[model samples]
Target: MTAREQTEAYEDIPGTWVFDAQRARQGYHLNEFLYSLMKAANRAAFLANEAEYTRRFAMTEAQRTAVLRRDWNKLLELGGVSYALAKLAFTDGKSYQYMASRMTGMTEKEYVEMMLHGGRSPDGWRSRAERQGRA
Candidate 1:
């Protein structure tokens, strides 16, 4: 079907034309339905990338699926490098650092410092602390 025909069909459906009433009343058109579709696509892409990253990084099967589903809370529960994996899926290394800072309760400077120092050692924070104390 044509674009206009498709839009008309969409409007004919009950509770589907989110933009129609608002656009009519306001005399300004905003394609809310199209925007929603784009947002969903973007989210799906992000989830797919998260899955790939988890798989490549050797995450647990359950954890990999959780990231693939964009279950952010489940990702946090997985801990270790899961947060870093999420950031990597979303951005480049520098942007990931900024995003990690925003999402993980750390300052941007702190995030950068951690990256510079090689963030999240394999043994994690407890091992790092012990090693530091011994030095």
Candidate 2:
């Protein structure tokens, strides 16, 4: 398959977002803003004025919205890398587990239990088309 075809195929997977080169470029500014939270002063500034701080980055409006909303799924859909997003979570005084649980639409306790029990079942829909009965 051609590179474009392969990328299209990757998009078929359910609940999965590939951080490919395209995504890396798309998310460059967003990731940079997120990574900036690594510094205490930046974190404080972001916490003090989220919209203002976020505006400093040249991210798409959708990406800006996702970041402010803390919409983990939407952020991922908009190319936000998980590792970089973790910085935002940390800045909020939240744990990676908490952020992950929110991403999976589960409570922290439920997410923890699920992990302890070996994670999601392999029997579920593997692709979007499969779930739609169109595969």
RMSD of each: 21.9, 1.6
lDDT of 2 by residue, 29-76 (tens): 999999899999999999999999999999999999999999998888
TM per candidate: 0.26, 0.91
Cα distance off (Å), candidate 2, residue 130: 3.9
* Predictions in order: lDDT: 0.44, 0.92
TM-score of candidate 2 relative to the true fold: 0.91
* lDDT by residue for model 1 (1-135), tens: 976776666554331222344333432111121122234554465445644433334445665565455444344444423333444344332455565575546788987898789885644223334445542
Residue pairs with backbone atoms closer than 3 Å in model 1 (clashes): none
Question: Which candidate leads the pack in lDDT?
Answer: 2
Clashing pairs in 2: none
